[model samples]
Target: MTDESPAFPPPPPPMGAPAAPPAATPALPWYRRRWWKFPAWAWLTAAVVLIAAGAAGGAKKDEDNASADTTVESVADAATTDAPPTATDAPTTEAATTTTVAPTTTRATTTTRATTTTTTSPPTTAAPQPIVFSGRGDDVVNLPDTDLMVATISHSGRSNFVIWALGFDLQETDLLVNVIGGYSGRVPVNMNADTMSLQVEADGDWTI
Candidate 1:
């Protein structure tokens, strides 16, 4: 007998044997498979892309934050450098000047003058001259001297008449003389020592 495997194969797997697993469905490539299905490479590739994107974003954000920090620091430094300096107390200087004045002197001069005086002598007056006369008669008579005359009567004549005659003649000489006579007509007459001699005359028994 030729042992020929029965035509169709051994009897189909017994019903009890776990039915051959349903033919495994062919795995589709990642691009052609349903969206829910994924291969290891596909998941790995997606995970790598996401990780790279997150890293890139984080780097950009850090750079931005760094630039902001640099800008703030630069602004603060600039403000410090540009601020004005503080004031200090310093002393000021001043100059002093002096002036002088001169004094003036004056001199005075004196002058003297002389005066003259003249003395004059008083005028001399002439001396009086002496008078002399002699005569005798009973009637009135006259006796003459240099510039004077004397007259007398013995007949009781008024004395005024004798004085009038002497005064009238002697006025020019400016001399004084005195005479004496008797009380009644009969008595004799006499003359003062300083007088010119008196002349006498007799009229009847009386001397004039």
Candidate 2:
């Protein structure tokens, strides 16, 4: 016999086993693939992007609110603006009142019991310069000290009001006004005030 060995038949497969290999999983379409089958890192990245977008929107909303607040404050300031009420500011118009005294005249009587009549004239006096203060609404205006002052009040509105002229101790001076509507009048300030000011309660524009 030659040195070649004879081949035997293969052994039988295990009982109940299938003859073919298992089938491969079916592939999904491109659109449906990433819906639920995405990896852990991909889902985390998507969540991060959503959170960043929300934060950016919130920040923009806060900035818009701040800008609105600033606009409101600016409008409020303009509505109640007040003019300068310093005591030193004076009007440019000048008014001078001049008085002349005539010489005494002596006349002889023509009729009987002739007598000479002599008339004497009083001394002339000059009027003081006027200090003017003007503004709208209610305010306390400071004034410079003066030996004598005439307060000429002029109101444009028809509402009745009163003004109190305070002395250096904040007490009511002799000068005051009580009237209604648009009025133009003057009051002599008798009481002297080292620190003088006017307390006004009125409506509409006024000048003094």
Candidate 3:
């Protein structure tokens, strides 16, 4: 009279003891299964290294450019502020001049007579003419190669000379002509041809 419960497959192994279902295959993660995570870490490290190197290179380049700019600015300032004009900076041109002076000679005759003498020389140099160029140097030009002289002079006391010849001198020899470029001794230069006379002005040594 049975009505007894069916076996029901041994009650499904007691609801939790079914041998753990083969351990679920351990669920190998995306990184462990495909080995792609190793490459990804490598790529990330390489990217970081490249970024650091690029930054360092850029910094070095910027430093170099800054140094060069500073050098150029300093040079320009020195040239503008420190350097003054000198004689060797310009070309010399020939100027025409004439002079007549009367001198008194005393002889034993108890009477003095005034003797007049006429002299001619090149006109004294006037103030240095301003010439502009891009850079600093010495330049020469002319047909007879007179001089492209630049000089600086210094004088303390005043003298009673009429024409103070202050400039460089051109000394000629027998065989070859020597160029002595410097300040000359101050000498007197007078004129009687015309009323107005020309003279060279300098602040350095006056050459003969």
Identify the candidate with maximal lDDT.
2
TM-score of 2: 0.36
Per-residue accuracy of model 1 over 1-208 as CA lDDT, tens digit each: 3322333443467876876654444454556556555667878999999999999999999999999999999999999999999888688777677777777777777776766777787888886553323233332234344442332333333332222122234322222222334333222222332233332333223332
Poorest stretch of ten by lDDT in candidate 1:
185-194
Question: Each candidate: how many clashes?
Answer: 9, 1, 21
User: Tens digits of per-residue lDDT for model 3 on 1-208?
Assistant: 3222343423235666655443223344444444454567877888999999999999999999999999999999999898776657567788978787889887775777889988889898897564322211222211122233322222322332112222233221111111243322322222221112123232233322
Q: Flag regions of model 2 displaced more than 4 Å.
A: 1-127, 192-195
Better of 2 and 3 by lDDT: 2
- The TM-score ranking, best first, is 2, 1, 3
Sort every candidate by lDDT, greatest first.
2, 1, 3
**All candidates' TM-scores?**
0.27, 0.36, 0.24
lDDT of 1 at 65: 100
How many times do residue backbones clash in model 1?
A: 9
Per-residue lDDT for 138 in model 3? Answer: 24
